[model samples]
Target chain A: MKTTFSLALAGMLLSTTAALADTTITIESWRNDDLTVWQQKIIPAFEKEHPDIKVKFVPSAPTEYNAALNSKLDAGTAGDLITCRPFDASLALFKKGQLADLSDMKIMSNFSDVAKAAWQTDDAKHTFCVPMASVIHGFIYNKDAFKDVGIDAAPKTVDEFYADLDKIKKDGSYTPLDMGTHDQWEAATMGYENIGPTYWDGEKGRKAVIAGTEKLTDPQFVEPFKQLVKWTDYMGDGYKAQTYPDSQNLFTLGRAAIYPAGSWEISVFEKQADFKMGAFPPPVQKAGDQCYISDQPDHALGLNAASKHKDAAMTFLKWVGSQEFAQIYGNALPGFFPLTKEKVTIKDPLANEFLSWRQSCKPTMRYTYQILSRGTPNLENALWAASANVMNKTETPEQAAEELQKGLASWYEPQQK
Target chain B: MAQDRKPVRWHVGVFLAPAVIVYTAIMIVPLFATLDLSLYEVRDKVAAFVGLGNFAKLFGDPNWSGQFWNALWNNTWFFVVNMAVQNPIGIGLAALLSSNRLRFAAAYRTAIFVPTILSFVIVGFVWKLILSPLWGIAPDLLKSVGLRHWFAPWLGDPHTALTTIALISVWQFIGIPMMLIYAALLSIPEEVIEAAEMDGITGMSQFWRIKLPLILPSIGIISILTFVGNFNAFDLIYVAQGALAGPDFSTDILGTFLYRTFFGFQLQLGDPNMGATIATVMFAIILVGVCVYLFGIQRRLRRYQF
Candidate 1:
């Protein structure tokens, strides 16, 4: 009996010591192709820095991310640190007291005010996340394809842009603008993220719409959507049949002149495209209009309020905003535009070109699904459907615009009470 | 009477308890719970009772009815296509394979059944690539046959997208009906065929008069199964077209609609109550279909002992 008791005590002591030696901090994020790089390079560097804490990443596909996160958070089975988009989804969690307040952290000093404000809760006081990166939404074009079509330079005005498209269309050798609306979201992505700012008069107009003070069907918004329909001609007959990946391949293979895509695609383009690639801001509304790029923060890291390892998780969150982590991020996936105020040089030329928009042009807020409230008709979804309807000639621009207004009203009017 | 009376069969209840408990826990309980939730609306993360408001919105409100009706019609079209194309083709293949004189019958049967065993993801992606105009073999094959001009992007066009997906589903699942019908054909006694032969009914006539009638019950069974399966279908369309059911939402179906509502997409928040409402509606649809078959059709279709 004494021997058994002694053995039990020894086993307990060994297990306790092993547990004390390493603390695991779990992070939840959407699965990306860069995940392998993150696992190999990022996690190891962090582990090396803090020997007492081990980090593990939990990932779900983009489609499944929100649903999986919601269930996990509700069940209190979520990771120590969670990845969420800025504004609403994170704000919802914050309101429910699911996230820890990070306003007092010294590490947050690395972020710009704009970056910090993007993830702030409603009171604009406490922050729930460390902003990681922001992507510039714009057009990715084949520089060589433009030259082949006898176009010497990227368009600076709306008419010049249309003229370039016509030139490529007249050449009859390649598709002018490569986009596949088969998945349907691409149309909205192009409309709202890439081109909407140019017509909505940039960030101020967007803030107005989000504030519900300005209507979506106003003349300013309507004009851009009307202009949006003209590109249907350049998309070719297979545009409806075209999937996003198909367009990517078309652009990469030099089969298309220009592709409207986000900065996130830079890494893939650099690896795949054999020809010279360049990026340009969506053309200005008139000859003298200053160009703007939709700069938006991506997945931000937040601490789970229910986490057992609160100290370890906080330590990891602080390290995330550090320059060491930024260097690791730059080396592993240079395409992502880092959000830190520190000077981190990127080596990828295409990435640099996309970032150049930051220097030369005004930065505007990008459209996010987060603006639409939960449990209401989604304005973003309605806009996507309406845009597709316009392209298909099923709905006039007026009708589509009205439909959006109605959807917004459905959500907005109810909340007024 | 006292001698004939058996003691209470407590063992029978004991034997049935596990299955009943499991079924009640997993299926019946969830089903009832979903039905109960349909009458509520979730606002700001709290569920408030709204009665038939969701259903009214689904059927009557302009914002939702368009999508709801589109999905319903598409689902109906999907069911019709399967019944019209999948069943007849399955019957024909089954009849051919059941022939006693046919050589390598087992191999042919196995070859035809291969696609049924494949998952929806594999089938969706494979068909997507095969039908893709960019890097697909389809356009090339058509060109070789001098039918290149006839080739169109079937999956991309709003008019043909749902039909194309349905036909692809038919191609993958045709083996199910074929196998079931084949089994039914084989179960026919040799004496019955011999007797029919003696009566001068041979080959096509013999099949029409004898074999086809024997398999009516099986055909009815296959039809109802196809209905339920098609109405509840989701994965194929999702893997192929995504939740938007794009090219102007031409391929939207009830299953996808339910999924989009329940889980939410893009900016829309997930509403469990509304999802429950959609599920309850789906249950009613399936229940009505099953009842009509059970009472209206099956009662008249004879399952002959011979």
Candidate 2:
């Protein structure tokens, strides 16, 4: 009887010892492609800072991430820290109280107002996540293509932009715009998002449209749709079949003159591009019109509300928002312009070129996010379809605008319940 | 007196139990669960029972019905293309390979079956590249044949995209029917062929009169399999054209549409209820097709015992 009792006591002690030694903090992210940075740099640096807590990086493919995260969240099996998207998707999680309230975190104070606002709940009192990176959207052009075509500078106006495209066309050697409309989202990202924000420059204007006080089919919105169609003319023959990676390769290989893409692509282009790469904001409608570059925060890290290791998760979140984190992010992941407001100067020339736009142009989130924050889902896909329709001449600009308004109505009516 | 008693056969029940349990758990349970989910509506992130509301919206609502009809029609076309193109070519190849004196028959059969072993993602990407007008070897090959002008962006054109995808799918899967029919053709008795040869019946005449009739049942099975597969095909289209199934959703099939509705693509939030509705509809479609094949088509095709 004494031996059995002693055996039970020993088993309990062994289990407790194992449990005490295993203080792991798991963080989930969709950026599996950047596993090298996470495994080799970020997690190692984090573990060094807190030797007691071991960081485990959980990853999913980007295409499957949201569904996987949502399933895990529903099952109450999500990781301690989850990388979330901004606006509606994050807002939904925040509403469900799935994310821990990070409003009281002192580290959040260092973040830019845009970053803070992006991850904030509808109440505006509580924010769930710490915004890590803001992607700058603009055209990354070949400087050699500009010089060969005898164009001195990146066009500041719509007229000059068209003129330069014509010169590049006249040069007869390169495709003016390297665009892959095959994915459909690429056009909406590089074309509509870039052009639409310039027309709908202010937040009030965007909010008014989403609120139904202003119409999406209005002339202001219609004009941007027209501009998107015009951009397609510059995307060479059989451009409809060209894919996103194919378009990027065309630009890097010097087959095309200009490539409109997000700042995230800078690191990739730097490694592949042969010639000098330059970037500028999408040219404005008229000569004097102020342009807005599409700037939205990405990979907002949130602590799961149900996490067992809340203190450890919070420690990591704080570390993620620190200046040291920004330095590592900017240096290792060069494309993303860090939103931490720290003076981490990214040495990549393409990154510098994209950053130059932030100095001169107004910053706007992707056009659909304004509508999406109001709880409209699939608005980006609708706009993507509309852009494709206008480009393919399947629908006129007016028709496409009407369709956009119709699609928004579907979301609006459903939400009214 | 002991010899008059019969032995108990408890092993039959024991052997069948595992399969029945597995099938019920994996297939039957999920199928019914999805059907049940179709009767609910998700609002504000909560699911509430809505009865026939989802079905009404699917068939009655213009926005929903338009996409539904397009997918149904596209799925029908996919099946029809496989039947009309894939099966015929497969049969022709199988017939040639089954010829008694044919050279390198094993090598030819292996070569034909190679693509069937490839994953949908690999095939989709490979075909997309081959059909791409830019950075593709197709244009140069066409030019070499003095048919450069005939080379257009077939996969990018809405009118051609669905057909192109169908053809690519057929190319990947034709080996399945070919092998099945080849096996069926080989099962023909040597005495029948020898007897036909004695009557001066040979080649096309012999094949048409004897082999074709014998293989009708295999062909029938292949058609049903193709119907089921075509309706369920999602991966290839998703990998190639993505969730939008563009060139303006020309390549949108039932599987892709169901996926988009359920999982939500891009800015869309996944609606499990609506997704379940689509699954229910797809189940009904597959059920009807299978029932018709089993009761109507398969019943008519006589499988002659070798």
Off by over 4 Å in 2: A1-21, A341-344, A371-377, A413-417, B1-9, B44-46
- Name the TM-score of candidate 1: 0.93
For residues B44-83, could you state the per-residue lDDT of candidate 2 as single tens digits? Answer: 7688899999999899887789899999999999889888
Clashing pairs in 1: none
Highest lDDT: which candidate?
A: 2
Candidate 1 error regions (>4 Å)? A1-17, A368-370, A373-375, A414-417, B1-5, B51-53
Best by DockQ: 1
